[model samples]
Target: MGLRTIGGWLQEQHVQLHMGRWLLELDDARAEREFTSYDDVRGLAEGRFALYIGIALTLAYGVVDVLVLDELQLDVSLVRLAVVLLFACAVVVTGRAIWVGRHLQVSSVVLLTVVLLMLGTTLGRAADFPTEYLTTSCTVTLFGAIGLLRLRMHAVLVMAGVYSAVCLSLPGALQGVDALARNVAPTLGLAAIAVVIGFSLEKLRRTDYLRQREVEAEQARSDELLHNVLPAPIARRLRTEPGAIADSAPEVSVLFSDIVGFTPVSEALAPEELVQLLDTMFREFDELCEARGIEKIKTVGDAYMAVAGLPEPDPDHAASLAELALDMQRTLARLSPAWPSPIAMRIGIASGPVVAGVIGRRRFTYDLWGDTVNTASRMESHGRPHRIQVSAATHALLESRYTFSDPQVVDVKGKGPMTTYFLLGSNL
Candidate 1:
């Protein structure tokens, strides 16, 4: 196989501990893709400025060529103008759809070497001054390699090899043995300096990239936890304001469900069993809530609370909550065989304007206040096992769409006798 193909394949692999240092890389494909994405964006601004500076220097050198008395000045000017215009076009078109990256760095080094070789061929040949410009050419190539281009080791090596090969061969072809020997030491010394600077800069850049990835991952985890603690809308408001968020939802339905006879059942079972039971049942309730367009409010002990139409307004908030409550009953019936005791639930729903917001500085909770919340809780406490009791307001909203038993008057605490109904099933 060709040496260039082998070298290309080697550069694509992540090589660690290469001649002692400077080969910082990731072995995993996912991490490599992530780093490539980061490197592409990071190199864009740096490479663009470097490109601008290179273009300016090329134009200035073309002017200097005209000032010098040489027969090849016209040839040199045309070459310089062509190189400058090519890079100038890169300046205009870059950062639009196309971009600059490691390849840009490699191209810059190769093109700079090409310009020097072209100049040396046209002017340095046949001049009485032997190998005087070779040292300066090596230095200029190193400047673009380390300072202007900031190339990685592989690309820097390519630049060094091309220049060294030219210095070794052409001095004999153009000058003599003495000229080849004179340029050798300077070429190698400058190449060493370029590679060293490139290594250190790249090592530091890789370190920073890893650190940034870690910080972003941490922020994502923290955001996920925060979103779980509160509703997305409430959490966003809390982040922007970082204060007490008190929002009055004009019309929302609240559902409070409690496991019937769970207190005595908890006494009979082991702590682990009790917790498993609650987790299994509540997890199912959570799924039902999500499926039925309900936002889960915090659960207290064996009780599960949910709301609809608060964070985002749902026009049929009461009807949606009604559907969720019935789903909870059906879910419990399906799960009854595995339970330690015969499982039943009492769910109460109410619809009205309520004050809802995040409360407490530590262990923040999204809670509800006002008569509607109290009425819902009271309806659940007064409710019968295996039945869904709802307030008059909720019944008013769902009456057209649902089947309810006869309205009955019940004495509820914190309020006088109130009219309530039992949600049986859907009309169809």
Candidate 2:
């Protein structure tokens, strides 16, 4: 082989000698993807990973002790001490794994490995213990580092490098070439395979975590859309049991408003300008409703609809609607100075029992049914420009808290002469 080829091979061997460096050389993009998933599912996976690894480590130590029991030609007291030390290490590592953070957990594992390595080697030298036993025990420990512990790539790699090196060096140095060849080669091969397996498992874990997050995100978005389309209580009911929604609210207040001169203004302006004007005007009305905690039902061509105390009961629903009416009048008056032409609103409000429910399936709407809704519409249609009209029901509810014009007998459509009053302002 060429010198450059030999040099490249040697460099490859050096990286294999240190698994940490090997992981660093591996695909970084793959590592980042796996880490993102690992971070997302840490709470769930940490306990599972720790439990399995703790069991594996404890079992590994037991097996090693049993295998070397007959071969340990040392003082009984020293052997007992060694056994006590190994068992104690195993117990400490396993217990700490349950509650420690990721970094500390990795540190605990490394500490256990180092303690075992030092204890085994010290005992081996004093007793003339077989190199094969020590090599096997150490190799098993390296296997557990990558295969069982399931730490981050760098942590596992650092561990594998240390144990694998000790297994390779100590056997050949103390025993012979035969021991080195038998122990080191297989340990290296197993360590490499374990690293690959660990990485694959991490990738798989990340993919499953990402999929679960995607499902949760979609569910949240669906809930948000439902809430936006319907009232909170109604939306919740629909989620639990979806069907026709028809319920009579014992009492509620409904308000309807229409632009005073929209037909003429729409004809004068371009479609975009007209739409923009309506959007701006209605947006302000929406803010006023929101501020008063009223629920906006929907807006028709040039009419806006809102309600109070239907989805949930409010004792002062009428007062709240009255405040919203005065605010709407003030909002239009302030904006009219900047408009291309004079703009005004004709508002109507009624308070009474009404049946409210969602209508249609594909393009659904939450609307009210009863004479109360019709009267509110009539209070808008038959009323004068720049005036907020209310039926006797609404007027009675707000008469104590708000000022109103003298009651007038107006000819309401469908319902002949009805006593209504014009809302002037709030007492506050």
Candidate 3:
């Protein structure tokens, strides 16, 4: 084969073996966005693994230092001192790793410590000692420290290159071509393997980090959806216990408003137009409720339902709901002229004890039950167009603070004759 073709094939093999493309050449911005959670996981791993690796390296290199001195019979004080200094550095690195385990800079610090150790050990080698022995030690130290520290691939590559250069050039500077040639191939091969391993490790970490972020984002969306469907407190309870979530609110103001003459309007307008009208009016009602701190319940056809002092208690619930009903009436009056026919709402409000909860597992809904809700519905059905009807219980709460018509007896469904009033406007 031609040299060019052979070289190309070998390069391709190297690319495939090392996971194609250089480490840290990924779209770092995109990776940072998608793989932010990776920092936490990597920091934890570094914090936990750093101390152990540091201790182990200290012991391993200390033994090698003693053996080299004894066997080579070169009892150089500087060599012994370098060995001691390296061990002491390891101790400091281990302690620092433990202390700053949760920090992002720990990885960089650990890698730098390993590089310094490699430099010290190499410099302390006996003059007559074989370059091959030091080469093997440095190779294993560089690669092993990286794997154990779980350093970032880019940082690993940079440090590994610098360390490799130092180790390789030592023999070339000291003993010329023969020594350089002996260690060059083995060093390159080991460095190539280190690159593959580092890249593979980072890839795995990135995969896991992205998956965790995706899961967390999905969970947040789910929680938000649940809260939109139900009250925040009720949704929280349902999540904690997958069962019926019911509560008895002793004093809540329930308001039910229906667009007056809805039947004629529905028949006159197109389906989309009718729907748009209802949506527009109800959206106004929703805003009114939100402004007044009221909890809007489900809307049926052209009717809107809402309540106050629910999911959370409010002593001024009656007043707040009354304000909401007034705003809704004013809102419709201002916007009704744009519709095919002028719109008017018959609003009813009742204040009393009621049972509220979410029902059904498939399509859970926050709803209310009890006489208060039924009575409120009845007042709306029996109300006059453009008028706000209120039950005796509700009137009692607002009578002192708001203007209301004199008591009028209305026969409500499932309830005997009851006193009701028309809420005019707030006295305040």
The model with the greatest TM-score is: 1
Candidate 3 per-residue lDDT, tens place, 13-45, comes to 321212334654223444453343445456555
- State residue 20's C-alpha deviation in candidate 2, in Å: 14
* Model 3 TM-score (2 dp): 0.81
Estimated TM-score per prediction? 0.86, 0.76, 0.81
Candidate 3 ranges with C-alpha deviation above 4 Å: 1-41, 71-114, 117-122, 125-133, 148-150, 171-178
Alpha carbon deviation, residue 247, candidate 3 (Å): 1.7
Per-model CA lDDT versus the true structure: 0.73, 0.70, 0.71
Our tally of clashes for model 2 stands at 0
How many residue pairs clash in all the candidates, one count each? 0, 0, 0
- In terms of lDDT, the best-performing candidate is 1
lDDT of 2 by residue, 1-428 (tens): 22222223333332121134444322234434444445534632443464455455545654555455655343533544554565456555545554344454355455646644654555455554566666565665555544444455655556666666665555244356766567767767766765776566555554554455445555666767887788878888877876888889878999999988888888988899888878888899988977888999999998999999978888899988988888888888887766678988899999999999988888787889998999999999999899999999999998988899999999887999999999998887
- The residue-by-residue lDDT of candidate 1 on 241-294, one tens digit each, is 965899899899999999888888899989998889789988998888778768
Worst 10 residues of 1 by lDDT: 1-10
State the local distance difference test value for candidate 2: 0.70
Q: By lDDT, highest first, what's the ranking?
A: 1, 3, 2
Off by over 4 Å in 1: 1-22, 66-72, 96-138, 145-150, 166-178
